[model samples]
Target chain A: MTDMVMYEEEYRQIQEVCARLHRDANASAVLLIDKNGQLISEAGDTGHLDTTSLSSLTAGNVAATGGIASLLKEKEFTGQFHEGEQINVHISIVAQRVILVILFDERSSLGLVRLRVRRASDELSSVFDSLLAKVQQPSTPSIFSEITDEDIDNLFKD
Target chain B: MSFINYSSREINCKIVYYGPGLCGKTTNLQYIYARTNPDAKGKMISLATETERTLFFDFLPLSLGEIRGFKTRFHLYTVPGQVFYDASRKLILKGVDGVVFVADSQIERTEANIESFDNLEHNLYEQGYDLAKIPYVVQYNKRDLPNVAPIAELRDLINPEQVPEFEAVATTGYGVFDTLKAVAKLVLTELKRGR
Candidate 1:
């Protein structure tokens, strides 16, 4: 968690892509939720944003659907898309460890967001892979594997 | 699969549940744990906030019915649903082999359901997975609820891809086994196909 293990530049690139997506999709917000459903980076904001609840919902989304995907026993999965009336969100897994979420209004077309997000995801993956390599090689504690049982317990310390 | 030791004859697979909050995602896991024989399942851990909401992730290791010579072992994970928890969710999704989507069968929850569903795809892509190629299934939970959407409507709205879909009242254990069976079967089928 020190200064964020992921490089700031990588996130800036994600933000740039997200901002452009927001303009193109005309959506209210674009967010990046990790595999654990933690919001990493976001763009665009409107009134209907609830950070906590939405994060939980998104994580639950990945868990439940991903479970089924495994059950079907087909192959690995890429991502899922949910379309709504006033609000349409597109979520994609970027670096196998990061989730890329984009929220837009009816003005956002699924086609445009899907296309741009795909390109951005490749760049995002390289950045993350590099960052992960740095973390692994340096022998530092990443937010992922570094937390000790004590740390986890302290999270619940009253 | 390299992360797992197959030489030990244990077929370990990472199965993740993906859905929106309050979509019975945890409930589905709970039902699976509750119904499983004590010897077949291991520790069920939930890393949640004081409010009882999942903070980072929840993990449970299960040993399902074995096959041929391999023991079917699965590591089940539930990611934190809050929006800010993307970092944690991505970590949990690493090296996943299968996914289950729990769609709340309520009309009003359509937006949340879709958002959560789309998030699943995004995460999988990062893991180098193809959603269509993955062993996937859909569970329409909360069927006992008053305002729950009909199964047909839920099917039409959520899973137009026509994968293995089931109606689950995860709380009462209805269709829970069906969901598990579908996914496990698919997982094993995939393993066999590779053979």
Candidate 2:
């Protein structure tokens, strides 16, 4: 698979989608993560959470689920839900490239979060499509292409 | 695959530690986690069995400073090294940017080392990655053990590609940072080459 490159335009668009989902779903927090476990963006009350660990574990969960799906000869389990005592989590894959997660308390119901995520997933997919197109264009300069050997060595210097 | 977030000024890469059961893959990560500064590292998560063997994987997120203006973040993972955990191993190899094969250095475990090495290549091939193309390094761990094989013998069997290799005793942290730095350097260099 080719590298996933995120430009400023797409980033802002993703952030907007996540923010809207957070408000509409009444989620305690909303997180968008790459399949590789990188946190792309987050919204709402995440200050108390360990979002980095959450993103990594969520990606692992999706990957393991995808593995089980393949074993059963199914396509993939595109969405999953977990009900907790005080919090509920709704996770869905967006465009097969990123994971969209919604964490809601009693303030929201699973039905509302799922409904809101369907629209947000569509918007996020389209934004990612444009981002992929931009990434594939030969005219788009890669940041790595300009990095020098000295620059790489500098990272290991201390 | 690496993820470059220009908007966030960060580059995220995944590096996996792979080897046979009890080959010290988790120990390598544990040592790194113990040594890293709080500000530069996140919580190290280990999903393991009740017996303490890795069940799925061990994940540690680290910030290896910056290059130019972009922060370089690495998500380090260790696969469940037991032979029966092949399915879990395959899952962890997904989207790996680099690999470190931590071979058990004891002579008795030679076959297991070779088998795990072949498994790494086979799993990567199934995922469309060629062993030769990826930034990879090898570590002959358990070097402090009395029954360990010679480095030269281990190299002949495991380092046919002549990839950067190190002798490590993961428990005491010997050669740990060297192995980490060598692989991380190769990974960054690979990134610089835009692959």
TM-scores for every predicted model: 0.55, 0.99
Weakest ten-residue segment in model 2 chain B by summed lDDT: B186-195
Model 1 residue runs over 4 Å out of place are A1-158, B1-6
Residue by residue across B1-195, what tens digits does model 1's lDDT show?
Answer: 211222334455667887887777777788888878998886576777898887767766677754444455676777776666666676676666677898888889988888887788898787677788878899888888889877777777678789999888888999887887777667656544433
The candidate maximizing DockQ is 2
lDDT of 1 by residue, A1-158 (tens): 11124444555766677677667666678777655444556778845566534654675667656656666994546678887877777777676566777776666678877877777787777767776666456554323242243432332232
Each candidate's fnat, listed in order, reads 0.00, 0.89
Model 2: DockQ against the native? 0.86
Error of 2 at B135 (Å): 0.2
TM-score of chain A of 2: 0.98
Report the TM-score of the second chain of model 2 against its true counterpart. Answer: 0.98
* RMSD of each candidate relative to the true structure: 16.7, 0.8
lDDT of 2 by residue, A1-158 (tens): 77989999999999999999999999999999999999999999999999999999999999999999999999999999999999999999999989999999999999999999999999999999999989888899888887899988888886
Residue A32 alpha-carbon offset, candidate 1, angstroms: 31
Best by lDDT: 2
Question: Chain A TM-score for each candidate, in the given order?
Answer: 0.76, 0.98
The per-candidate TM-score of the B chain, in the order shown, comes to 0.93, 0.98
Let me know the TM-score candidate 2 reaches against the reference structure: 0.99
